[model samples]
Target: MPDAPLTDLQMKQAAERFGTPLYAYSAAELDAALSRVQAAFGDARIWYAMKANPNLTLLRRMQSAGVGFECVSLGELARAVKVEADGDHLLVNGPAKSDEEYRLGGDLGATFIVDRLGEVALLPPASRVLVRVNPGLSVSTHDHLATGAAHSKFGVRPDQLPDVLAALRSGGHTLRGLHLHVGSAIRDAGDFAAAFARVAELHTLTGPLEVLDVGGGWGLGADLHGIAARAKEAAASFGAVLWVEPGRYLVAQAGVLLTRVMGHKQTGRDFTLLDAGMTELLRPMLYGAAHPVQALWEGEATTSDLAGPACESGDLLGHDVTLPAGAVRGDLLALLEAGAYGAAMSSTYLTRPRPAEVLWDGTQWVTMRRRETAEDIWAAEV
Candidate 1:
């Protein structure tokens, strides 16, 4: 397992300077993660799934590192454009794409990931296309993360690929290749092997293609070499170049959510109240994600549920978390592996201001985004 990106003293410094409910990322860790993927994928094109952490600063870093951007919405496309990413470096993907998204993606000359047959007609004329294939294989992950499952509303079913391809070609669009993305946070290599095997079977129909995008969903601890080997074989079978879009795998372990302990209580379950909760980090309440927590102070160990300041009971961060018995108000707690979706999914619920973000570049702290103010939240309202 990888260590937390920020050091104890660094986290403490950030918390003190930026206030609690903050996000701090390590630049060194981000580079290391990108290097690992490049080393494993070797010649395969790497497109950073911007949804993981779409901060403009991070996006610029990725673009400078020669990583492409995989965008799912118009806003993401705009972000990619803001980074000055050309069509070659941008891949527009989504199950339900809006007209504006299509127009802008088309104008940018991005290769679109067609999810269904109907999308073939909706795409920009002569647009570059990669047909998303739904392998329909069960994967080892949260049900919500299993995008390629038989009934998930993500990709075209295996049986529907031929029709999709035919539609694209007849519509005068360029068919770049086939795309297979089983799910996110997948821990099992066999799940990938099976999905690749399923995709490999489509070679008889697809013939030789230009690119085969085996989408990324490797768990934080997943074996990249093993998964890359299978992905290589699948692309080889199709006689196409390999591409990967890694979202969380590259950024998740590089970020820490810094929140302060606000209070403690005991009602059947001992509770450690935090300044940050679902509004700041919703994975725990939404996907039941369990991030490792580390306390800065030292004392006797005690187990308690980490609760947030929300009025709802489901806003808990962790259950039965072990922390210092001497912890008190203003104490700091670091939530590890929060670099990916933590700030990207943050909301201004309860009209609370969102947290600020900083990046540790090994030399000094750089503020990436300022904390939202109460006035900023409703500034656009009439």
Candidate 2:
């Protein structure tokens, strides 16, 4: 069964044990999500984009499930390596590639996703690589999140493919695959079909492609079956392996942000103030993303605005959300579907300490990451 929000008892226990404004993940949820994806995209390689949630325990769970690591930075690679992730299953991908990153990827025997000529130059001679192609196809997602548009800075432009491929050969890097990432939060199957159709045509650029990296932008309501079929059909046409890097789909619903209602007020509008804000979960402020929120107590339903302790007005967590009527101070509330980009995109804005992260393994909860401290935040400056 798909994972559901934590029970009121579990939420209360976690807050009492770890403190409020905490990130609580479910190991059972992770396992169930992995199984769903594995069953959905049978025979296709699934690489977990650790940028979503790189908690050590999450990484270990993914690794144990035979999921590969899709890393974009040296730090993520280091974490994967620490967990003894299989080197061959790893893929190094990012828009910018530093010399050190290239060297580290090569040393780890991971395939590089070459996005530009400079990245191609950085690869060792005859290294296996996939060139990220920007086919200028726009999906229904946000403009900033859409990467396949002509003006996007993410992938190699289609016009530059010839020169890029030539440069790749000149630099001694063998192009074994093609890649495209249209955007995130995509749910339309037609969008993926459009991208996959473009990928099929790009396969002509390389002789006998080994992998077709269709890219990942799947969200909660995405058409998984339709997308999987499109990819399978394309891979069958080229007889190449299909690879998908899912960052949010497999893990977003596996966690929640538990925050307490510090107090309530009526300022022309009902307000529930929370101790957490964009400082702890930035998706609402960053992308206007909405997550389901509920209260622990039972009361008349009331429409209330949820705001954080941050000074910015945009620190609003939710607008006109329904909470238990008369919910007051110390009421526990949960932000659902927060596992993906929640804590991963947090900041130390206002110098607010980040929340602790805990994992529930069906029977008990374990600390995955300790709460940040004031000294830890200022350590870099000192």
Candidate 3:
């Protein structure tokens, strides 16, 4: 699915099988991502961030593989528990967790990564906690995704650790270890290594750390093997076992949002309308991301920009892109690099439904997540 690797015949087949505007994934690719991330971090524990791709099938695969779960909200918590992941391996992160969510996490025996002092102090006694430290280290990703700096509302500031931990300890909070995530899509492994050094210093300063999780963002290089190797080196000095939370690095390469050209029109410059809109995939409009588009069945590919079928002027999958030259009406197009945030963030805006999702199992395609329909939108209606 990465780079829209879905072939013309395959795209057409998928559209025919599951219907158009399908958000399909490759099971082989997803498994490969799991294998790569596991290989990168070495033998340490890995809690696949279920928020990345929470499709029941994906969760089932991760659960069966003995991976843990990382939840940011109560809903995510429920999703993990539904799969019956081992309680010991469940980790709850993110700031601003509701009181009920905290209670649920504690009752579920999932490790809670404490972000704020207020919640830490208010937490019930004997709470299992991992202090999420805002090292003031910058992840250098999009501001929306950066979460480790002091400005970030993510975790407790470094200066506040002493007082925060004192309260938790006094409250009988079970101190586990220190956790820090500089940011998302981290391009530099050295930055990660340096961040670990800072975390180690914290552990030494605080006492002994039982666990250390360097929240994973993608590494600098795009090469999967290189990415894994980099992650292994970054946590080399930490005495405690290391854990990583990778979402995009694990799923981005393995998925694509398959769309079809419903209508083609020429603007003063040139514009083509796609059946897939921002409602389905918003990375381009939201973050100006690069989702390499490919044409299946269309011979050599032509130089044509593919814009998502959204009314917004900024709704575009790619601009002035090149696929097969002969690609015309009904030609299936593949939007690569959609696996991470595609279906997870989709909406039913503009009255357009999201695509169905299928997983390629090497032998054949399996329906991992069924397509959404009109009934899906109103399923919760009174």
Candidate 4:
């Protein structure tokens, strides 16, 4: 992987303007990623998985890019609608839905993704749904991110699946088709084909099932060969209208977490501390996933640990990470490939303020979200 170096002025300017622990992105980077998705799907409806990062700015940006949304909550549905999501295209996929939220999503024209017999009866009239099925399969990814397992809480198990077809046949619900979210960060083509084969076997439909939503978890900036090949094969195998929802793969490589070095310390071993932590970026602790991390400088660089200021010993960004050896306090460090969940997971834990966010448009950088202040925390408490 090519080291993403920062221009001398850009680093200095970002540190000067946005402060440390800031999250930065490139409009061009995101645009290119989305463009690739458009090219790959080629008419497949891609709904931005809002649960990945629901910042209004990110949602609005995706909306403007001709993408719809996959929402799971009342707030997300409202946000998607507020941002002018096409009424016919909004997708709702969640286990629990308050009766009010159910009506709201149905009334707003969002397509419901059903996982329970209870939902079939509770869903409002005229509501359309796609049966979410568990193919008794698994995809190779982090254990925490694997949602296709039989024990997973996300989808319908094969035993319970007959109940779904029975409900669709007996109940007055409009069952559109099937919805399957198998895994996240999938990397192997054969693995994908195997998963597709299992899900494709469900196409022996006997009713009004027309559209098949193969939820997306394609790995981005890592390897497209696996998913690209499987996608081509799946298109041929299913022979039905297909839809995919890709978030991290579409935006991860397009982002950078621009945090400044807070201080350096040497205990049992050498360490570099930053104002960031698990609060700012939680993937490491949450999934033990490694994000490509690097320090950007005007000249040379070295590998170092980017430690978060959080009290826990587990609060590390990247271990044995490459950074500038000469880097010191206030030096700008760009944690590359952080576009998806970086800023969205940040919190006011220990009263440490979360940082601002910016978007680089290649020609210029624009401040998308201002840094959180002390009172921003206090105001929420009251």
Scanning candidate 1 in windows of ten residues, the lowest lDDT window is 1-10
* Runs in model 3 lying further than 4 Å from the true structure: 1-8, 219-238, 297-302
Tens digits of per-residue lDDT for model 4, 1-382:
3454345466557767877777777777788888888776677778888877777878888887778888888888888878878767698888887877788887887788988767788777767888888776666788787787767778786567777778866766677778888778776545566777777666554333567787877766445545655655554555657778887877787777777777888777568888777988888888887887655544465556667888899998877776657766777767776777777777888887887888776777788888888988898574
Clashing pairs in 4: 302-323, 303-322, 303-323, 304-321
lDDT of 2 by residue, 1-382 (tens): 1234577788889998999799998887788778777777898999999999988888888887788999999899889889987668789999887777888888878888988877666786678888898888878877768888788898887678888889877877777778878889975768889888877776566657788888788877776877889988877767789888988988888889999988888888888999888898888877778788867878987788889998898988998997788776888888989999888888888888888999888899999989999898899993
Candidates sorted by lDDT, descending order? 1, 2, 4, 3
State every prediction's TM-score relative to the real structure: 0.99, 0.96, 0.91, 0.92
Candidate 3 local distance difference test against the native? 0.74
**What stretches of model 1 exceed 4 Å from their correct place?**
none
The local lDDT score (0 to 100) that residue 326 gets in candidate 2 is 74
In the order shown, the candidates' Cα RMSDs to the true structure are 1.0, 1.8, 2.5, 2.3
In Å, residue 149's CA in model 3 sits off its true spot by 3.0
Please report the candidate that would top TM-score against the real structure. 1
Q: Which 10 successive residues of model 4 have the least lDDT summed?
A: 1-10
- Residue pairs whose backbone atoms clash in candidate 2: 126-172
Residue range 1-382, candidate 3, lDDT tens digits: 2234455666677777887788877777778777877765677677777676777788888778887888888898888878777569798887788887878887888888888888876565587888888777766567766777668888888788898889887888788777777877666555665666566666545775567777777642445455445444444544566677777777777788888777666776466678887888887777666777766653664566677777888777777776666556777777887887888888888767667789877667898777777988878889
lDDT of 2: 0.84
Model 4 CA deviation exceeding 4 Å by range: 5-8, 205-208, 222-229, 232-239, 298-303
